[model samples]
Target: MIDASLPEKLKEKISSFSDYKIFTHKNPDGDALGSVLALKRILEFENKSSEIFVFNSIGAHFYFLPGIEEIRIQKEFKDGANSPALFVLVDCASWGRTGFPFFDFAKKEVIAIDHHPKRTDKEPLALEIIDLSASSAAEIIFALARELNWKIDPEISFCLLAGILSDTGAFKHSNTTPKALKAVSALMKNGVNIKKIADNLFRKNEFPGQLKLLGEVLARASLEPRIRMAFSFAADKDMKRHGAEEEDLSGLANLLSGIPESRFSMLLIETGAGKIKASLRSETHKGVDVSKIARLFGGGGHKLAAGFEIEGKIEERFEMIKEKIAKESASWRI
Candidate 1:
């Protein structure tokens, strides 16, 4: 059953303001960037002014998307006494996920559009369009455009298709659905280059630095025979030695997930001083909910893919995390 009220409400909320601020999670991925960029284009079509804010710099791979240059690398929220502006959180539910605090300087309405499962402790922003069944937030954005009777321009199609391709892994992931395929068909009709999108996303990371980083990750990775899991860690030194950027580590967990016998994979990277980031991945057929594991460590994402960050060295509590993963997977049939 489709709840038509949410998009209708989104339309209403969007119509209420002329200026808007769009946000996505930190270290924004393809789906994150794609969703926000597409929304920015949509707002422009409606004659609304908008700006995109990302906490970290995006990878060069996504620079091919339209309007990539205008993204502001925001450090802090500097809310002033400007005219009323709507804040739209795309691909995430809370402002905290944007790697920034929710500023209470003014009374403003926020709308969260996401495809992740609804969080029980989400922020007070209620104009949400969360669809867990959708393959990607891009899918939800396309649906909203259709519901609001907005034209799907070429730029919007490019951005949305980039997002869908990203989350679906070029229609290879388990989340690929008939709706996603239909969206692809429509976007193709709009003349989006699937080959270009795929090449940029998957093949563009074949440089020497990324290769060295991959070698380090693979060499350090360990396979837990008991749980059929693969795990590894990359520290600041490893990244520096390899000249690898954070974007280079993006698909390492998925690479580990390709191990034939492994049911789960995790990659830990030291993102900042005393701060470690963990990426977890499992196959949909394996029936492992990585998000549940992430939630245990104060982070969340989809079932097959999720992540969390902790304030400590990579080796500080790795054994403890392994114990938690073991306990979590104990009930699995695999």
Candidate 2:
């Protein structure tokens, strides 16, 4: 949970910053992108100049966002002696995710604004503002803007709304708090099209994407009959054969979680050459914590929605994981 006294620290930084650069996680999700843009808009309203860096074609989905034209890639320009003096990392915990090329140069002046649960102070971070209870990092930004009474333009609202909608899977996830709803209500009031955003995010899909989804559900899927849970996996080859993209698989993991009698659901996709990307959900199971499993495999997420990756031949190692998960399932109860 983020400390209530966090605002005082944010205020202190705002008072001192002349110029800053905003960064987000690699493959930046909607929440990550939205947080960066929302923060930039707020600072701009205060006449504080800033720049945003979106890495790995994160800006490719520009149509969904408001001011996509202004977002830049850090590698395209040089950071000189007088360039941005501060770096703001949004929706990212560790430094590796922050796409800023000059991270070592900007380490002392970086600020981390995220909403993931934490156990302790991650060493070497300058300013940390995290509140897992808030749902989206955008929600935290909303609270910060209100605390500072900063002007939130319609564009800012759009950014924040994008973050909120994306992270909560359009309010399907458990993290959607009352405060999140209230923040979204304000964004809607500020002219964000809730319908359009939801449609673009959830409904829009090309033929290839549709085929990818169909193939995944029809072929790759498996059901743990004992737990009433269904799962599936898509290897890089599967994606290539169906002309698939990562965006196409973004929420496909949730499909199996809807089983009528399910206690839990999961999915694993081979995203990397030697890595098996996983999605573990607690659906109706209360006795298991996927986070513990994820930690064992060098990944992390919430108890209800955790993920991990394993190294080796995707098919060969998957059986080992399934056996381990079955053992864990034996100890599980609704």
Best by lDDT: 1
Over 4 Å off in model 2, which ranges?
Answer: 59-62, 74-84, 99-107, 119-122, 224-229, 260-262, 284-287, 324-334
TM-score of each: 0.93, 0.85
Once fitted onto the true fold, the runs of candidate 1 whose alpha carbons sit more than 4 angstroms away are 81-83, 120-122, 327-334
lDDT of each: 0.84, 0.74
lDDT for position 106 in model 2: 36
Tens digits of per-residue lDDT for model 2 on 14-106? 779878878777767788878888888888888899888766566345457877667885444345655546777788766555544443443
Candidate 2 vs. true structure, TM-score: 0.85
Q: Which TM-score value belongs to model 1?
A: 0.93
| Residue-level lDDT tens digits of model 1 in 129-216 | 8888888899999988988988789889999999999999889988899999998899889998889888887876477988888897
